[model samples]
Target chain A: MLSEKHLPAFYALGALLLIILPWILTAADSSYLISTATRLVIFAIGAVSLDLLIGYTGLVSFGHAAFFGVGAYVVGILAFHNFEETTFLGFDGTLTGLIVLPLAILISALFALIIGALALRTKGVYFIMITLSFGQMLFFLFVSLEAYGGDDGMMMFEGRNILPAIDLNDRITFYYFCLAIFTAFFLFCHRLVRSKFGRVLAAIRQNEDRMTSIGIRPYSAKLLIFVIAGAGAGLAGALMANHTEFVSPGLTHWTKSGDLMIVVILGGIGTLIGPVMGAFVFLLLEEFLPIIFHELGMDLLKEHWRVVFGPILILIVLFAKTGLYGLIFKKEG
Target chain B: MTQLFFEQLLNGLQLGMFLFLVSAGLTLVFGFMNIINLAHGSLFMIGAYAVAVLTNLTGSFFLGLLLSFPVVAAFALVIELLIIRPLYHRDHLDQVLATFGLILFFNEGVSIVFGRTPLFLNVPEALSGAVQITDTFSYPLYRIAIITVGLMVAAILWFIIVKTRTGMRIRAGTTNPEMIRALGVNIQALNTTIFVVGALFAGLAGGLSGPLTSVEVGMGENLLILSFVCIVIGGIGSIRGALLGALTVGLVDTLGRAFLPDLLGQFLDPATANGIGAALSSMSVYLLMIIVLIFKPTGLFPVARAA
Candidate 1:
């Protein structure tokens, strides 16, 4: 089995690659790769936050995209108002990331608190369904916001959020900006999982009744982690809105939540770095699978790549029980 | 206004029937097999596609609908043996992931074969006309037929589940699968049978409702989520719960959309009212599910000894 001792090396290697990737892609005249790289990093952030719930706490929340969407919409809606020179709920729009990012995190945390409070009352499948419903509720809410473009979504006209001393419009700069945020979150989550609170979460996942018997109420601990995860996802969402330069209700869909889960599982559920690796692999497959199909004279299959991808996902779940991180790093189970 | 209200009520009932058909299968699978089959929607989607193609081929919507049951059953049988059987012992997370993959496969596969454009069917000639309920209002015969079929299926399902030998074993399996297996019953075959039956109902709903809506890729997904909400509201394993939950969700959703905007317009400006109403109505069923779950976490009609 993989030893935890080697994880620091893996983390260092992964971070080094990310740091140097822009130069490598630019050197190869594949600077477009930076765009995809940025997305993968942003999604890695979302996937890692999800891992906190699914892996550490054993809460398989299916509505996680709600926070992610809320964060993106916070940026998108603010940018929309800035473009129109109007106020949203009496506040003038601002493109400043310093303000928008924190606001996004705060609002998403609030959403998580409300949803978690109601949803935590139910256990197992009921919790999953309630969270899914809440996510769908948020999705539909955004879809009905005609002022912000509704189903079609809204775009940022003024470009990416303005950060002090950061030129976000430059691809490499934005890529580095995203990379820096991802690194900070990655380290924070790493420390968090080793903390006393994190051990308690792991204990709760194993035996909630036992945890309760020991005088620790699982609800507050679980709810706290849920809020933290939501805040993290919201930060990712804010970055995503800037990266894509647009926001839509689709971001909050249950399918998006599913995608984040898939990424986490693809890497290795419990490992924070696993989701980041999973994001790298997933985005690569999405980018190149269609091209690979077309090269093999399966032009019809190019657009229908999901037909192939779906079975791959099934096979992974069925057989690759430990995911990619475990596949590469673990010597044995 | 009364006529419009009546028509919307029927619409709600019609939608409720669809929800029951889908949720009946979902709840049974979840209850008995201890699996959450996200691809149950794919089976429903296939049923609609089957009806569309067969109806066009045979020139009779009824014949098409009848044939779709067997087609969907066969599909369900294959899926159960190859995929679901292996997952029966797995955790909910694994089952969810696998079935979600199946959804993507089936959706993309359908689109590849049928093309992205949605297929449509005309209502069967026999039920094409409307039945007059009053001087000012007439309800579509096809919709009424859907409701009748839904109720009939519910009755038949109730009989099979409550009165028959098979029903006895199913109830036993849900509570104590190991004991049932030890009791000399072929649990594998029993599981397959239940899965096929569930798939049949979903297919029947798809075929019957195909003409009322466009037969398109991913159509079953929206209905699947709604039915999931119904299952959550009604109680996961109880057929009676599924019925109550389905009807409540269908009614709330339809009525909310139909009258919420106008009702709001009475007090607010039309534009804002319409926007808020549309948003709220879309969320109404979910809100209802949340409220119900908050009050009765087990659902309104939870089955005792559910897996």
Candidate 2:
């Protein structure tokens, strides 16, 4: 029913341009474009993982940022100790930035495993609140940990570990590394969705009761996907800390979770690439809207731009059934 | 020390009442509408603003209190008609996002209109002095008045809900919206009324609280989360549950902050005890919530059905 030959050549052109735009934009804007793009890519990765639950699995987690924050805190706490110091484990203390990422994933996944196991038992509004309650639990934990800069947050004075062969701190190189990670994740997520596992996830999304009728335990599937999503988000958080060289409660705030959800909805659910585009738009709006408003001497509007942002959401949900991606590509003729 | 303890208990009760005022409407909205309204706090903020402005305009506390109900309820009606009504048909994510967006909008709007500086209101002279509770403890008469007023309001609300016709429709609609519709109730009007009731409750809390705390921009944001935790721990929709949850959270929170340092000081060095105490104090409420969730996933007073 579908053929690569029939897909528009312009689609390929668009993808190429997306990749190239960052390179050119970074050249013109220096590190801003690269860092911004990297941030968008990181958030996009998290969003795709969320898509596995929210889009494919039909599970909505208002507390997804708990994982994101967990990943970030792990990176922060590790670096707080390991920035220049040796570890208690007796291993070489100075591993590269890439080495810390998997650790962050495991730590975040472990936390998610515990929280999700309990949270998944409840359905509907209970599910939302339980997840939120767990998120708040973590938030207060971080807030109370005056040991790690507490509410104000700590700055990473050190950047990513310099690979023995190549400098990891170079803006362009770091940008590419992040870009490669994003591309790999996108492809991985694409393949994941096509796998038979994706089909079960979809079935569970449609009806867990029926899935259980067929002998597939929905709880394990939901928990597994939740942890996977958490791991994915955790990776994004690790990259986020490395890219910005700072980690704060801002990463874990419920509002950030809401922002991530907004991105997924804006990009269109069930589509792997939608969140990437959505993240791009959201970050672009954050970057540019204030500048435009300030330059126009409407600085008052700067603080209150959500007045405009809110209406955009109302309009988007009302008029655009899918999202910007859906609007642009009309479900393949 | 005994006096302070007594005072703090009263303070905790006062805070619990404020939480109740906010939580009652929030719980009703959540329980009946199945809508997680993050913007409920915005209504609280709006109520505070209303009180602040009215107090400034008329220089009368009663006038401000009197006016906030209608103003806040009217605002709720408009919001319900425009934004929230449509969301009833959608899923929780949609409701969450739209309400969250409303939070941003309302917070920024208030900040712009009212400025970031905290607004202060003075309690009327009639309620200002301390009442001699004990020889060592002289609690603020104003706070005592707040407690009396809060208790009265809670009682009236209980009475109205348990012994009123409108409350029946709300209870019915919450349990079964389709059945209520099938019974030919005007669900739209009923929903708007319940939303208004919720708004008025929040507004009343705000009006009552303006003198006690700083009425500044973004005041409602954090309180919103805390109150949500209350309802979640209380079980989503039960009035009695909300009250119990609020009192429990208020006491645990206050007691932790008050006594945790002293408790830890006995075991550890003073500095470490202070740090650990503060951390534990902040965490104790959430710990209680998680413990409750662990044992009773449906919350203490399972409203709809046990999970």
Off by over 4 Å in 2: A1-15, A26-31, A83-95, A295-297, B305-307
Query: How good is the docking of model 1, as DockQ?
Result: 0.89
lDDT of 1 by residue, A180-203 (tens): 999899889999999999999999
Residue B77 Cα positional deviation in candidate 2, in Å, after optimal superposition: 1.2
Candidate 1: what lDDT? Answer: 0.92
Docking class of 1: high
Q: lDDT tens string, model 2, A91-197?
A: 54443666677788898889889988888888777777777777777787788778788898887677665465656588667766777787788778888888988
Q: Which ten residues in a row have the lowest lDDT in candidate 2 chain B?
A: B298-307
Model 2: per-residue Cα lDDT over B1-307, one tens digit each: 7767777788888878888888999999888877888899999999998998998898898888898778998899998988998888788878887888788788778878888899999987678888887676688888888788778878987887788987787777767788888999998787788889989988888888889898987788777777887887899888888989888888888888898988999999998899889888887887788788878887899776222
Q: Judged by TM-score, which candidate is best?
A: 1
Please, what are the lDDT tens digits per residue for candidate 1 over residues B234-276? 9998888999999999899999999999999999999989999
> What are the per-model DockQ values?
0.89, 0.65
